[model samples]
Target: MSASAQGYVAAELARGGYQNVHDLLSQACATHPQRTAFSCGDDHLTYAELGSRADAFARYLRYHAGLQPGDRLALQLPNCLQYPIAVFGALKAGLVIVNTNPQYTAAEARHQFHDSGAKAILVLDRLLPLVRAVQADTELQQIILTSVDDLQQPIYESQEDGTLRFMQALRLGEQRSPVQREAGLDRLALLQYTGGTTGVSKGAMLTHRNLLANVLQTIELFDQPGLLEPEKDVRIAPLPLYHIMAFATNCLSSVGMGLHTVFIRDGRNLDETIGAMQRHPFSLLSGINTLFVGLMNHPEFRRIDFSHLKWATSGGAPLNSEVGRRWQALTGAPIREGFGLTEASPVVATGTQLSPYREGYIGQALIETELRTVDDEGNDVPPETPGELWLRGPQVMQGYWQRPDETAKVLTPDGWLKTGDIALLDADGFVKIVDRKKDMILVSGFNVFPNEIEDVLMQHPSVRECVAVGVPDARKGEAVKVFVSLKDDTVDERALLEHCRQYLTGYKMPSFLELRDELPKTAVGKLLRRQLRDEASAAAS
Candidate 1:
């Protein structure tokens, strides 16, 4: 508590041992040697096994692929066990891992691959088509396709579509590449892409220290109740691993704390997740609002046991009040909603999982994180007033890759990373996000950036001018709402909708449509979305 004690601790921290995620994992693997570190359906991996596989993959990447240090490898997959395997493997091989969401389109995928200068790609078979379309144009040289049952022996065929219809589908991956280097803790572990909710997606250059700091920060956040103790804590891994929340909370947290990370294979099966929850008596379950809502909606939700649930953190999107209340009522537990972006190592603030419910608020800063609410000019805003949330802490990312101009705009000279969402902090320091600076929609937990939507809408010949806005939705928090004005008055709503569907994901497509004689624009002729939102709200009222 005293200044002398603080200085002493800081001096000790500077002594440096394991400087990265790989170093952190190495210690964990050694400490918990035979403990189960990761599990999916019937497949379980012990800490020693996980570390061994990663090292083997690392050797494979170097000896066979000839990928030297500082190179990037693009990985696009869902929440399968291989997600961690590949991520750890890449880190072991001294390569930067570029994470991609399987749901991304060819255009979205290309932006990340080209921007990051990735040389190799690891993909799931079902997503192969999406990557194949863009590989010819990108810098990637090798493609390694993984099956859903790669971890478990005698892999079953779940489906030809790559869903792993049965656990027996996995065959030995014929070794194609060899990995040759040891990953130093100081090197980059992940080149995570920004959601681009505001504009073009930029890769946040996160080093081993950046990610490792956040992992320790998270451990402190939950250390209050000792909820993270291994052998006692079991975590649900249903959230997409590509997202930082799952990568950090579900996978990295498990390794850092020596807990079991259970993968929710085939999220379509509600019984599987629920069954795992009961069988394992999971102590902690971290996820987004949509997942909790979906879980409660399932017919078997009532039957699953929540007797052992100790930590339930909600992030990646706002946790709806209705879902929160219902979950508390059913399970007698609070869904602690937190807030973070792809930057900041994806954790700026979080609510207390063991405390009472604080509806509509993303809780206090984790230990050692200092936050500020500032206006466009960077001056501090009064408490309870909305403004962009800026943070200067151990968890904030280093910078954007290769885009000095872009990074300069977001990172303040004093080290604060400007989060584009408008937020308000109560006198108690709890943050509540009121609005977003970017024209982005939060459909469930997915980001639907308006610029991307407008780009798709503009393809229609009849679309003269258009604007994409987020409309409130009861179930999804917000849905893509589009406003359009036709050039020749020859297009119908159906045709325009069809054009958008062909290019974007189902969640990104507009849920509400409006036709206008001419869109509301500023005096200079730039379309004004706030004005359109005002009109839409007025009509709704």
Candidate 2:
């Protein structure tokens, strides 16, 4: 888009009167009061109902829990009707939300709660045991438990163990007057934790304005003609809301655009997910490459209707060309792959419907966002040369919470946030990610990206999923290692190695190969390459 056109779109998006997430919710509720805002299975809520419940939860937090503005509250729940309610409620009460993963173990839960100094937490009933194990070590003063069927089941009173039921809190809030608060743009809205796969996890401090700007940016992208119908789109929400990508896409952006979202608590269940897709004439679908591959492999998935699909996006991982082409053949909608990280409100660039199938490219930067490919010294690199991507935009996080030393390593003195991925920016502003800076393998002083090796291995008919990592080698200093999960165990390892040798150079060829039943991945289906590297290192030691 041209500069003038970009500015005009930005002006139009700014008219939404968004000072924070609460403002977005308020605007949506007012504009589309009776529309179905969110639904899961048979449970659904209108815009008005969602607004009232969110306001009630906010009031209960103020008058009942006594949590002050800027205080932290960890929300540990899966994708249910109550997830968005808790998110909006926490933001409306002016509390900084910590989006906790419901799958966390006791130690993981304890570390986040204690580090964030959260006094309150909202957890699901199924995860109560894990919370109870870590409660004494953290600063939690109040625990609120919810159920998957909380909205469907009969209402109950608070328990005697000083725990409050999720339904009871809403009822209590209804009895009290609503607390009025409008958070400023600079106020912190969420402390989203990341970096767990690489090493220690830290919270990325995102402000209300950071999130609001990103939502507006995304809306501008989708506002293009033939991409998405504004306020009338139906989306299938298969990704977990705890991840940044899903939080911004489904919980905030889709909701802000007035799209009705269908939540899927268990995205792994192909039968259930396909059934949900069939139940609704969803216009927009969003997920990672693994999900698309799973759906394509399922016997019943191809029978579902996809006539209404206007947009299909893949994020949270690289989209394989083979997988993307097969998906397009089946669904008749090309898989537009985008790139993002947790620090930049999760979305930095995306592919539009106009140019959906640029091989290995992540389209252009968002309007009002500036991107630079820089060398190690912060100088701009030549066009099409891979370098670390530096981003300066309103959507970038403030810094890592309470870790200034660590934050200084990534964020520059001015405003640029250093993304750890190696990428190349073309003249037209299209970005093609090479790989993570840390994930690059150095063999005989040559840098090799794992994506290239994995892409080659993915072409093999027997390989279902594969990840490449660098392992120690006394002769070459470092060598490439590949771990793969096959379609079945009948395929010979020698044939796979021969295929790799035919496609890759001597240095890029895998020096070691291991077969596995499955590879480690994040909840969002991002391949955990760091985990494989760690495993290899431990085994070598």
Candidate 3:
């Protein structure tokens, strides 16, 4: 039997109409052309202003850059004014936008750029070194590098066609590749990376239709029809745009509803994001579990006025029940936790403003999405039983890009994308994640795969046998814990962890280490991850 709550009935969500996300933007532009569309610091972009900028960007890409349709452009940026302009412009130009996290090092950047086969890249000045490091190995034919002050030039002078040859040597000084562009909703629009069972990241092929479908559904779920007066709601967008939830709730939903979004340039600048909320008193706040949890801890969070907040949505990791309780107690607005992946246009299920916020459950599926749990053999599991959650909907991605064999393994023949997430649906129809097929850790909104870490760990001669597991952490949500069986008695656990920091990201390194004689294993010699996890919990308690 699954460990799900009982008597939860779900209502269908509407993902209807509009071929792709482009129409949503176009519709909002037509409906609220003059309303403010986005804000960064003192700068405000009206719907007409944003749409026109996107239009100029589209024309600029086509005529100046000469990027053809379906040509992928690696977008390496953090949340700012350029992000939306570049994203929507790429969509308008009919090019696939492959989003990369700005924090990624050159190695990570190179891998993604190589895998995506991007012809061009748009990088922020601060991150130019990373792009410069990987440029030689990548397939990129051209680069469109911009600075922080790129959009500050009156929006008239700065947003124009300015050409500069980036490199002097290697015969690339005087020449720039012309642009090729695409137009339509059916075309591939975005390729967002999600971790695979194998621990390597795979690009999920999200069509314009897929993104637009999820965006429409999200609007239906969160839009306060009567409460949110047209163009009156201000939404706080602090999360990274590369994540689907942030993209949908912040960028896409804001466009469709014509809500003005305050772009949070840096998480390090949480004060700015929080102050914007207090000064403007945002009507809607959407982010991951970590963002909200961190905000709640901020001394400013206690001083803010909750009366203006109409909706709060959290996804990425499960909302810690304690965090949810504290939020409700503090702000009065319930946290509407949702479920999504890079594969399902990022939103499979969501709790609406109308639904009572539950402690752990990620509310009902959006309209048109059919979620079911099945055993290993693909047989349907009875209701309330934890099983592998599979999603079938218009929002589901086509497949993994250029990974047919791997895609076939996860994407079922009848269109069910095996989420690999262990989930349970109650009799009333609410879904809650319980486990994952891979030894993957959800550190805030990012996926930290153990295999990636284990490979790094094996490189150290001191690491005899190490198995990593997700240990519960209240702040970041989950901390990585590795149980080690040493080959040499002289190896110190602390030294091994420090060694891991060299190759693995901070979130992926083992925060807790346990020296063991020999790890518990199955008869087939597979390390029993469950046993290690149980040990971690027992020791913590």
Candidate 4:
């Protein structure tokens, strides 16, 4: 690591008030006791109530469930009141949190549970069948099932199948006092699973210091003049909290700043999500490209008042420039895009309120973070040159959990993380993420980035969603193939190809175009290029 980077990180941590993630909640409770901290559907929790309930859940883990410090606890629930309670509670009990996506299949669930060696899990009641299917193959000792309305409904103890209800556990937990456990800043706080798109998902081991530093870094960047206000801004959180972006931003950073976060249980359900926005008059919104497109297309979206919306953020995937422009036209707030991976506590750079809107740029690096673009030989590239992006900062993860071989591949011995993204840094220090190094398509010996193609395609009025992938070609080594889902049946393949030819060069233009009802995306709304590539290769074979 660079000496300057280390000095900056040390200084920031020294002045940062809290030591652990849960400590942020404690301070928020003390400072903003009566303010609403989190809400879902019709249920909400004041800062004080959230803290007390978290303490109760912590007591239940320690005294009732016999969970001890350093134990792993998997939280497998959607956006609900129990999600935040379980997260804060698990952290308070000195347990490492494994944020499991509730959409995981039985095999995926089994692999993560067995790999993390999770001793307990707080799962949604509807997902119990999948958990039960995989329970015998893993190290899970305790099962706590919860419904969407667990906090509002009456408690029911169902120990018949060796499972405990969420409300019942909280009720039993209230009988005991809070557990007093000392958590060092260096101790592991969360095992966030990532990299599933490439292969098997690996858990990124984030320490208390890593998460806290990111929270402070984000707060420093966004806390400009006339920007974010504490205890006043209402944030609409439609993304799943299990993802590292939402976990670091909404669950930790937003709470630390005393923001009232309204959770949308199912972001895919546009009606419910739009309804939440209409009801809350949220000042901040965070989402990816697909969510933004879906919201803007919804008939009810324009009905909601956007005057209260101060700023919006986009991540998880590249924000199409067309989408950003349309969003700004519809709502007065500009969609400031950010860049990060799960390893850097998920946020390395973001656009601030004062920053100018630049197409394909992800703003500047966060406070105390160092960013560089390195060539294939690991030498620094000049400004405006594209190379693999490298980051070194306090927010970087300790390492991947129990995967030293995998850890050695990404993290350097000198503490710099080799982000697999190809990016360009201009003379002004603004970053434009070219593409993921692995995702770069080599067509006729020239690098064709999917983002460049997708960006051009998205500008077409009829193109609702589009993705580009490299397919096997007999003449050239590989060829560009485009998949698109349109707004209507007005345009055919010839028209789309003609549209692409107008903007894209001959080499960058699509050799083949396929139209579909919709393209496949991840739960977080990232386009699945690998899946499409695999299908294309299979068809050719």
Per-residue lDDT over 305-397 for candidate 3, one digit per residue giving the tens place of the 0 to 100 score: 889887787888878787888888898888888888888888888787777556678888876778899999989999889999998877889
Worst 10 residues of 2 by lDDT: 1-10
Error of 4 at 149 (Å): 0.8
Q: What residue pairs are clashing in model 2?
A: none
* Structural similarity to truth (TM-score) of each candidate: 0.90, 0.81, 0.89, 0.82
Off by over 4 Å in 3: 1-20, 153-182, 222-224, 486-495, 515-518, 522-524
Of the candidates numbered 1 and 4, which has the greater lDDT value?
4
Candidate 2 stretches greater than 4 Å from native: 1-14, 196-198, 440-541
Candidate 4 ranges beyond 4 A from true positions: 1-9, 196-198, 440-541
Specify the highest-lDDT model's number: 4
Candidate 2 residue 128 Cα shift, in angstroms, is 1.1
Error of 1 at 432 (Å): 2.0
- Candidate maximizing TM-score: 1
What do the candidate models score in CA lDDT, each in turn?
A: 0.75, 0.83, 0.76, 0.84
Model 2 Cα lDDT, one tens digit per residue, 1-541: 2112335433644676566688878888888988898999888999899999999999999999999999999999888999888889889889999988786656668888999999999898778788888889999998998888789894567554878998888999999997775558889999998652234578999988889888888887766675676566799988888888999999998778888999998776777789899999988888877678778888988788999898688887777677788888888888888877789998889987886457889888887778889988999999999999998777899999999988998999998998888899988888898866767665543446787788889998899999998876643446788999999777877888998886565667898899999999999999898999989867765
In terms of lDDT, the poorest run of 10 residues in model 1 is 165-174
How well is each residue in 1-541 modelled by candidate 4, as lDDT tens digits? 1123445555766765566689889889889899999999999999899998898999999999999888999999888888888888888889999998886656668888999999999998888898888989999999998888888885577754989998888888999976875468999999998653344568999999998888877877765666888767999988888878888887888888899999999877889889999999799998877688889989998799999888899887677788889999999889999888899998998886788767889898887888989999899999999999999888999998998988998899999999888899987778998766777565533346777688878999999999888886643446788899999999999999988776564667898899999999999998888899888767755
How many clashing pairs in candidate 4? 0
lDDT: worst 10-residue window of model 4:
1-10
The CA root-mean-square deviation of candidate 2, after full C-alpha superposition on the true structure, stands at 10.3
How far in Å is the alpha carbon of 534 misplaced in model 2? 14
Q: What TM-score should be assigned to candidate 4?
A: 0.82
